[model samples]
Target: MDKVDIQASNANILKDHGSDNKLNVSYGGPKIGRYVSASSNISTGYLLLSESPVGSVLYKDKCGSHCVYCFSRLVAGYPCEACCDVAFCSPICRKKKKASFHQFECRYQEFLTGLGISSIGRLALRLITSKPFDYFLKIRKYLNDTNETLESNRSLITRNLDVIQFNAHEVYEFVRKDNQNLKPSKQIAIGLAIYQRASYMNHSCKGEPIFDNYGPTFYFKETKDRQKELKDRYWFNCNCQACQENWSLLNDLISIPKESLSYNKKLKQDSFKDLIHFIESNYVDGKMPTESIVRAIDKFRTVCYNMGSVHYLNK
Candidate 1:
């Protein structure tokens, strides 16, 4: 997926829950149900929302080569000036990282490395030090209110993510593999992030035409047993059209326009530029003409596959 540089402060549409119209949420036990808001009805490949991580941590191995704060590749960027261990993409990030949680981590990096602390342990340590005792105490006053979102102790800062196994997303730094001059590197889990909002229905949609970017999960099983496997693995079933109607797999697929895309087709050298033109022509006022978004994504996916980019976007 193409990453957009956006911040809540500057993005006009993100202010004051303005973007909330794109999603609908219902309290359905611990697993809250979320779908596209009927009123907003986003086209395919629409961005739902952007979230700042409540708490995040880099794996021990990534501390030196990658920015511990932003997780960007470390260059002549700022390193923990004292310890010279963990690095950051910029001096600004280094300053913010110090204030956020790195000041504490920097002090004990050597001690913690000796203990061979795991990434999860490092993240837990970050949580423990990221906030002060008074912050927790202040939130304690809301425990009695049923209307309070989540009144637990961990909820003091961010909603409790105690059941982390069900929510934490492993982040990766993937490079575009289509280019020959770009050096290919081993794909590794660099860090983990917890968004206040949860991952949604898009994930479990059946019969995805593209590759799965969320890394490998289970095998691409048949439609009959896929739902059961998804439920058993993820503990929830999706309500996407593909899942509901039991759409056939990619091999038995029909292209978007039934004439434009193909599984085995190769695209021209200027296909990427053509994609930009298509989007410029079709994507207007933050929305694409109905079903056109699907065509756009499908065409992009087809080009990426032909170019030998890491196939990870499944449907």
Candidate 2:
């Protein structure tokens, strides 16, 4: 056989294909091999396991509050649930990486569910709904019209939940402890560590992580003194606009009950008048209304309003 055929035959022979490892597993998109063995270049006894980020959120770095020109938000259009939180594709992955910052947010997983959103999906919705120009315009207007000092505005922003600040050392340690049982190379720590190599990412004042065209290979650095350096190397340390006021936003979000926002059952049962208009205006070619689509539009409009898009579009 030719080289191509031989290579194909070898791959077929070695491929796990339908093995238990492959079946009923939480695989998404494609699988990337992990780094299991210790590297002499950075050995420190901690068994290191590295793999590309998965799910929509962290794989895409959709965590944290808002940035004025958050490219991910513009693209994905909502708060990124998966990226915002270190969501794993499988329970095994989640259990393996639980020691990281995810522990802090995992407690609030129910809140995320209430919105019927995933981290990446939320980011996408926010982006789809945002009007960046108008958002900036409002920012300028608030500055021009109000006599508030820069510090006061900053405080207000901080209180509003535009940004999110976290303790990186705690997050790092959490992951290390949580994944102790997993195979050395199969463990993940932070959202950033999900990649194989993490040197290429550039920090942004208004950007989120991106992974297109390239196969997954981003990873967090395996530092010997991880907890010590974590504070310094954390993705965000300053009072960036997103974290300053993000808590308030989170509070506001939590105030709303999930059942109040749900449409799954009611959409099938109720027949409201505006539902018809919504279907005619926003749906595929204004086809006859279905309860499901109407409910979807309602949910979309709520998301648009929350991300400050509805007002932008109105203007």
Top candidate by lDDT: 1
Candidate 2 local lDDT, 122-193, one digit each (tens) = 333333233334566667745555454456755664441222222111011111112222111112222221
Give me the overall lDDT of model 1.
Answer: 0.55
Candidate 2 Cα errors over 4 Å, as ranges = 1-51, 54-94, 116-118, 121-315
What are the per-model C-alpha RMSD values against the true structure?
9.8, 26.3
Q: Report residue 63 deviation for candidate 2 (angstroms).
A: 18
Model 1 misplaced stretches (Cα beyond 4 Å): 1-20, 29-38, 114-117, 132-134, 140-161, 177-188, 199-233, 237-315
Q: Report model 1's TM-score to 2 decimal places.
A: 0.59
